[model samples]
Target: MSKFNYVLNFSPDTWTPSMESKAEENCLGGIQNFPFAPSMKIDRLGAVCDFSYTSYSRGRDPKSSQPDNQDFHLVDSRPFPKTKVRYVQRKFQKETAQAYHQKQQQQEKAEMLLRQGKKNAKMRQAGTQQYQYSRHRFVSRMRTLTEWSIEPLSSWISVAEIPLSSLPKQFLDVSKSTIEDIGWFGTLKSYNKSMDRISPKLPMALKDFGNMEFLQPTTSDDEILRDALLQPEKNIDVAITDQILACLVAAAQSKYSWHILVTNVDGKLIFDKQDGSIIDLITVNETSAEPPLPDNVNKNNRPHLLGLEALKSNQNYTQNIQINGDEGIIKQFEPIPFSEEHQDANVESKCYRYRIFSLPPRAGASSSENAQKTVRVAIRTEIDAQIPNAESENSGFIFARALNEYDPKTVKTWNTQLESQKGALLATEIRNNACQLTKWATQALLSSCDILKLGYIVRRTPNDRESHQIISVQSYKTKELSAQMGLKEENAWGIVRALVDLLSEQPEGQYVILRTPVKHVLRVYRIPDEESSELPQDEQSHKE
Candidate 1:
C-alpha cells in the first residue's frame, strides 16, 4: 500500500550501505521514467518535501493561466528583511590577554618579595652582634684547637657480669646462627726456607719470602650476595657484605674521596664498592699531619706500596705458622688450597671468617605502625686468624696486621721506640695511620675477635726494599684497642642505621654515595636504567 514494503529512515549520521541499496531498489521505476534524474533523493528530518510550488520559473507569458502581474506581486506576501551585519566578540583572545597580565603581575610580585626578604635579612644581620665582623675578617680568623683533653686509660674497663635472670627477654632471645664460612684457611706452614724446614724462634727474613704471590678474591661480595642471599624471592632490608660497615664507622675521620655503590632492588638495599675501588687498596699514613707526597720517586717509600708490602708480610707470617694440621680447630665450611685460578682464592692470611650479625631497629624511627616493626639488617664481618689458647681450653680469635717501617730516620727507630716508648710509638701511629687502624679495630670488634695483634716490621737495610725483619709483636684486647682509637660501638652502629634509613626512603633504583672532592660530605646519585645496563658484569663480579 505504501511506496515500499519497508519504511526507509535514512540519516547521514547513521547511514549504511544496506540503506543505500534499498533506496535504489525503491527508485527503480522513477529512474526508468527519468533516465537523467538522481537514483534517489534524501531529505533531512523535519525538512519540507512538497515540490508542487518549489519549481523555479522564468517570466510568465500573458496568455498563460497564471496572473500577468505575478512578477510584481510578492510570492508569499513576506516583507523584505532589513540587511544587517553583526560582529561576534572572541572570548579566547580576552582570556589570553588576561592570563598574560596575571603572569606578569605574579612575576613582579615574586621579585619584590625576594628583594624585600634580602633587605630584611640584611637589617637583621646588622642588628645582631654576632654579625658585626667584616666578611674578610671573619673568614680569616685564626682557629685554635681545644686545650681540654682526656687521657685514654691504659687499664681495661671491666664490665660487671649480669645474671641471666636479670637480663631482658629480648636480650636473652637469640636468632639462629647465620655464621657461614664460605671460604677456608690454607695449610699453615712456617715461613722458613721451605715447607719442610720450620722454626718458631728464628725470625724469617723478607728477602727469603721471595716471589710470594698475593691472591685476590675472584668472587666479589656483591656477586656472592646476589647469587646466594639476594635471590628474587628473598626480601632483605639491608645488606652490608662489602665491608661497608667499617667505612661507615670511620666516615667522620675519612680524608680521601671515596664512593659506595648502593642498589635498591625491590626495596632491598645492597651496599657495594666499584671494581678496584680505593677502599680495597690498603692505605698507609693517610691521616698523618704530613702524608706522603705523590711525587715521591721511591716506589717503596709510597704509602700504597708500603701498605701492600705490610699486608703481604702479615699474610705470610700468619699462614706460615705450624698449626700441626689443626684445620678443624675452628669451624671452616669448604676448605681449599690456595690457587691462582681458584674462584675463591685464599686472600691475605689464607683465612677469612664471615659472620652475620642482626641489627635491631633504630630507636625513634617513626610513629607509624610499619616503623614499629623490627627491621632486620644482616652485616657480614671478617676475622683473620685464631690464637690457640695454651692456658685455657677456649681458643682466642685475633685480627693480625703488620705495621711496616721503611725509613727509620723519618719517624724514629721502631725497635728502639717500641721498647722504651711503646705508648709514644702507638701515638705516632695513631696520628699517621689513623684510618687504617680505625678500620682494623672496627673489623676486629665486628668479628668478635678476642685480641688485636700488631706486628712491627722494619727493613733490614734502611736503603733496601727487598729485605725486612719483624722486630716485635704487640697484642691488645679488642675492646681496649677500640677504646684507644676513640671508637664507640654505639656511634658506629648509629651511623650505619642512619645510612640504612636514608637509603630506604629512596625509590627502588641503583644509587651511588660519593664523598665530595673538596668536602667530607657524602652525596647520593641515582643511576638511570640506560647507564646501569652498560656496566660490565665481569668487572663488577671480579673486583679486588
Candidate 2:
C-alpha cells in the first residue's frame, strides 16, 4: 500500500491509547488496513510533536510497554530505565498524600477561624462587633475582593461608525408605509411630468420608492405585522418577507402565476401560498447550502448600508444571477446558506446542479455519491481544522491564513490599548494603523506553521476504558512536507508555512479593468515591477 497522509479530525480531539486500540481492532477486523499517526508540527523554533490526541492507537503492543507520545525513544536515544516509571508513580503518590494531609490541616484551620469570626460577628451584633455586621455585606465584600484578580477588559467595542440603523431586530418596523402616507419620491411629479421616459403601462411602473422599501412603517399594525411574522433573533423583512416579495413580483412580471414557499432562515415554512388553494402549510425536512464569496468583497457590503459596518460585517445581500434565461438582469438574490448550523438552507450557487444535470452519468459512480451533505461535511471539517480554538479566548482568535496582507494581533492589541486608555492620541494612532492587530495575529499564526502542520491532537475523555479520549482529538499530523531551503526537520515548519502562504498570495496578482463610457477591458497584473514601475525604495520591502 502507498503511504498516504490523512488529516483526522475529532469533533471533541487528540489521539490516545484506547482510540489506538479501537483503531487496531477495526484494522484487525478487516474494517480497514494501514497505520496512522498524528501529524507532527515543525516550526522555526524546531519541530515538536503536538500530541493533543491521546486516543490514537500508537501501534499493536505485543509487548506490554505503552507510552504517551515522546515517552519512548529511538535506538540511539537512551532507553527509559526500568525503574523510571515506577519511581515517577511513587513520587506522584507521595506528593499526592502530602498534599491531601496538608489540605486537611488547612481545612481544619479554616474551620476554626470561621467559627472564631462568626463568634466575633455575633458579639458585634450584641453591639460589640469590630466591623460591618451584615452577613450579606460581608459576602458582597468578598466577591468584590475576588473580582480584583480580573483584569478589566471591556468587551464593549466603540465602533468607529455605524450606518444610520441598529442591528436588525427580530421585528423591523414596517419597511414600507402606504403610498398615501409617504408618497412616491422621484424627480417626476405625476405620470404627466415624465410621460416621455417610458411606456408606463408595461406591467409594473418603475416609480422611485426612494428609501421606502427599507423604511420602518409608522403604523402600529406594521409593528404587529413584524411581531407576527419573524423570530426574535431575525427580521423577516431581510430574510423572507421583502426577499419573497421581490421574487414573487419578478415571477409575476414574467407572467407566471407562481406562488413560492418562503422559509425562515431556519428553513421552516413561513409562507406557502401555492397556486390558489388555501395557502397550504407544508414542512419538509431541512436542507443546507454553501456559497463562496469574492476575495475582495468586504463582509458587510449591504447595498442599503452606507459605512464602516457595511465594510466589516461580510453579510450577504445580493448575488449576480441569470435566472431562467442567461444574460438576465442582476436580479435580487439570497446566497444559499453557507453555514450548515442553520439546517434549512439551499445553496444559492446552482452551478453544480446545472453542470450535473447537463452531464451524462458514468457507470461506476452513483449520483448519490455527490450527496451535498457529505461534500459539505468534508469541506467544513477541512476548513474548521485550520481554525484555532476560540473557546475561553477573549475576543476569540482569528485564523491568520484567511487574512489578506494583514496581521490580527497588532490590530487587536492596539484596539485593546485604545479601549483601555480612552486617550485621543492612542485612539488616533490605532485608527491610523488600524490593521496592525489583525496583521500581527495573522503573522504569528503563519509564522508558527509547525503547530498547524503537525495538527493538534487532544484527548477529551480522560477515563474512557476503550477510548483514548484525553482531549477529544483522535490524531493530527501533517502531510509529507517538501524540503525547502536548508532547514532541518525542526526548522522546516515555519519556513514552509510562510513559503506556502506567500506563494498562495501574490500581491501584484490583482485584476483591474478600466471602462470608457461604452466599453470595458479585463486586465491582470502580478506585483509591480520595481525597475519598470516607480516603486519607492522604502516601500519596496513591503511588496511580496
Candidate 3:
C-alpha cells in the first residue's frame, strides 16, 4: 500500500515533551552524521518521514513571517545620496520657475490696467455718446422746408421738399404751385408730371411694412447707399434711390423678409412676389403707411358696387311728451349730458409715425426689370436670442447678398427640397422595386397574431461596408432564445423583429429605429442608403 497512511498529523504545540529531545538529537545527528561514516546506517524513507512530520506538526501557525526589526539598517547606501541631491535641485528649479511666472503675470496685469485707464480717459474726452445721424438728418431736412400751405382751419401743412436733382430741369423751372395741395397723392402726381426725370427706370410698388424697432442692418444696403452717394457716374434714378432707402429702413425695423407688392392708391392688388413662408407681411404705400378704408365703404365690399349714404337725422324720444291716452308702459330714453371739459382733454402724442406712398411698380409699367429687381431684394437677419439686458445691444447680422471666404460659390441645395418631390427617395434608390413583397412584409409585421416574432434579429456588425443587417425569416433556437432573454420570454425579440421588418419594407428613406430595453427608449442607428450617407450636415449643425 501507500506510505501516506503511516503518516500522522498533530495539532500545533511547541511545548510537546518529545519535541525538545528530538530537536536536540536532530542537531547532533546533522553535525555527527557524514557521508564517509560506515558505522551510521542511513534509512532514507524514515529520514523523509521524520522531515515531513517536523514540517507539518508543531509548525508556527500563530506567528507570521514578517521582519521583527523596526529600526532601519543601511543595506544599500550608494543611490540615496544622489537621489537626495537631485530632489533638492528639482525643488529649487520649480520655485525659481514659479517666481518668474508670478512676476510676468503681475507685469501683464499692470499693463492692462494702464491701457484701460487710457481708454477711459479718451472716452471721457469724447463725451461717451454715439452720433445719431438719422435724427439729425431728419431735423435738417425739416428746417430746409421753406414752402408751407394753410388748411381750412389755418393749420399749416408742410409741402414736401423735392430735391432738384430728383426732377427734370423743366419741372425745376415750372411754378411750385402746380405741386401744391396735390393732396395725399402729391408724391405720385409729382412723379407723373416729371415723367422724363428718370434716367434709369424704377419699379413702383406698395411697401410691405415690417417691424421697425428691431431690424438688423445688412452690408448690402450700406454698399448700395454708399455707391449712390460717392459714385455720381452710376445711373441710379431718384426713384430707385428712394426705393432702396425705403427698403433699408424697413429692414432696419425687422429681420423678416417683406414681399414687394405693386398696388394702386385705392388698395387694389396688382403684382405680388412671395417673400417668405410667414404670412404677416403687411402691404403699405411707399411711405410705409397702411391704407385705411373709407368710413362709408367697407374694405371687403366689391369695388364695382356703390352703396348710398344713409340719412343722419336723429329721432328724439321723451316720456314727458307722451299722450295721456296711451295704454302701454312707455320706456323713457334720456340723453347723457356731454361735458366740454372732458371733450377738450388733449391726447398723448405718438412715439413713432409712418408715411405711405405708391410703389413705382405700377401694372402699366413698361420695364419688368424694375419689378424683378425689387422682388429680388430679399434680406433677413437672425434674431438674437440672448437674454435682454441694459447692455449687449450688438446683434449679429447675416447678409445673403455677399459671399464670405468660407461660403461655397454655389449654395448646396437642401435634400428636403428633393425629398419633397413625388416618389423621391432620400436614401437608397430602389433596385428590385417589388411593391408586392414590401406590402406583404409590412402587413405581416403589423399583424398581431403572428407567433414567430423571435425569428428575426436586428444586429450591427463590425464591417463598415455592411455594418447593420436585419436577418429576417430565421427563427431562434430554444436555447439561444432563452440565453438572450435571460431564460424569461417577454416577447422582446418579437417586438424588435416586427419593427425591423416594417422599417426594411419601406421605400429607401429616413427611418427611426427605436429600442426599449429597461424603462427608457434607446436609439440604435442602422446604416442608411449608400448614396445619402456621404451628404454633408446642415448649415446650422456646422455653425453649432
Best by lDDT: 1
Model 2, 33-74: lDDT tens digits are: 546553333231121244454633452453423434547666
Q: What is the per-residue lDDT of model 3 for residues 1-544, given as tens digits with 9 covering 90 to 100? A: 3122222323265322333344444444544445554442334323434554656554455432334444546587556455546888899999999999999999999999999999878766765343345457666544322111110111212112222222111111111111111011000000011111211122111111121111112223323323432433432222111222233122212212222222121211122222221111122111112212222133321111111000000000011111222232122212111112234442111111111122223222234343312111111111101111213222111000000011012243212222243133211111111211122122222221121121111113222211212121222233332333232211222222222222323343432222111112223232244522342222211110
lDDT of 1 by residue, 300-386 (tens): 776556656666666565544324344423444444333435555333334444444445554556564434444455555545555
Candidate 3 regions exceeding 4 Å error are: 1-85, 128-544
Ten-residue stretch with the least lDDT total in model 2:
375-384
All candidates' lDDT scores? 0.56, 0.24, 0.24
Model 2 residue 55 lDDT? 39
Q: Which residue ranges in model 1 land beyond 4 Å of their true spot?
A: 1-224, 227-235, 320-332, 336-349, 363-373, 390-395, 533-544
User: What TM-score, computed on C-alpha atoms, does each candidate reach?
Assistant: 0.56, 0.15, 0.14
Clashes of 1: 1
Q: What shift in Å separates residue 328 of candidate 1 from its native position after superposition? A: 9.5
Name the lDDT of candidate 3. Answer: 0.24
